[model samples]
Target: MRGFISLLLLTLGLCLQATGMAADKSVIAVIVTNDNPNKSISLGELKLIYWRKKTYWANGQRIHPINLPPDHPLRLQFSNSILGSTPSAQNDYWNGLYFHGISPPHVLYSDEAAIRYVQETAGSIAYADACKLDNRVKPLLWLLPNGETTTNPSFVNCN
Candidate 1:
């Protein structure tokens, strides 16, 4: 009976621990095409690119910013991390832009979709879990929660 009770308590504790861990967001790397000439971008510049303010890269290529569906948790985390805003903030911004007949970035359904889109499209950028990175996309910046950065030696050539 004592062993059964101990096992039950241990299982409950692990379940609670997993729940808390799920709430903690991790670092995301902004990925672009592997052959993109622009090696790096500042956080402010990246934010503007997403906002559609910085519409083109240095090579005169239109920058296509890709995003996951607004309801996705990682999408919320990306919006909060990069823009200091929520998904509703984006909806409001886009609604305001629509008055002028302007549109927003392409919304992909998953990180894999974003990766595929960026690879096929020139001057595209998107954020994804660092662990999901592949050779097709070159990470330009590694962003942590609360606006911090780390240079990813293997992923980004931003030295």
Candidate 2:
């Protein structure tokens, strides 16, 4: 309760000591399971993961890619920023992949669920808002729609 209250006050920028704490620090990022040995994540690799082009981790563990629910803003951002199109535009591709037994990434309902899943599962990765990030999961990379990429970001909450 105390933690939630503090977050609420900080979100409103109304706490006496929360004056400069900005949500601007938040971003869309790729999060991978802790056991992953990859030192850096790239946009190209993320695209391959979503396209089901990349299937295994370095240690031969199957990589489980996760998709965000359609209603989530990060879903659209991910679609455009990473997939280069909206979900509808890629419907045919998804269908073709399905026909060939190449399924799309599994969908998780929320950022929290994605984070928890990644934390508990090996070789799993998902895209989510960095604000919800913490020590429980490691963010592989942070990408802006403008083509900027951040590796191992220092999120305010994680600090």
Candidate 3:
């Protein structure tokens, strides 16, 4: 009976640990084409690019920033973290920019589509759930929940 109780408690502890770990997987993987010359981008520069205030890469390639739909969880997290606003606030920002002939980033439906778009389009950038990332494109930044950024994927703690 003591052994059974120990096993039950152990299982419960592990389940709770797993739930905590899921929260860590929320780190956003900011990806770019494999051929992109940039290996790292600061959060501020990323915001500029996404906002269309910075129009070109260091090599003079035009920057193409992509976004997920407004309702996507990753999008919400990204907007709050990198863009420094809620998704709705971002829409309003864009709405005003529309009259100035400035458009928001193109929206992709899924992480896979974003990955593929980044892979196929030069000078493009997008974010995906770190765990959902494969090798199609290289991750240039890791946006952590703690408001910090990392260029190293090993530091992302995806598991």
Predicted model with the maximum TM-score:
3
Backbone atom clashes (below 3 Å) for every candidate: 0, 0, 0
Taking the tens digit of each residue's C-alpha lDDT, what string does model 3 give over 3-50? Answer: 999999999999999767646538889999999998899888999998
Predicted structure with the largest lDDT when compared to the true one: 3
TM-score-based ranking, best first?
A: 3, 1, 2
lDDT of each: 0.83, 0.79, 0.88
TM-scores for the candidates: 0.80, 0.77, 0.81
lDDT of candidate 2 over 1-159, digit per residue (tens): 999998997877665444344323347878887767887787888889899999987689999999987656678767877888987787789898887899888999999999999999989999788777778887778866454667746532444
Question: Worst 10-residue stretch by lDDT in candidate 2?
Answer: 17-26
Model 2 TM-score (2 dp)? 0.77
For TM-score, candidate 2 versus 3, the one ahead is: 3
Error of 2 at 18 (Å): 28
The C-alpha RMSD in Å for every predicted model, in order, reads 5.5, 9.2, 7.3
Better of 2 and 3 by lDDT: 3
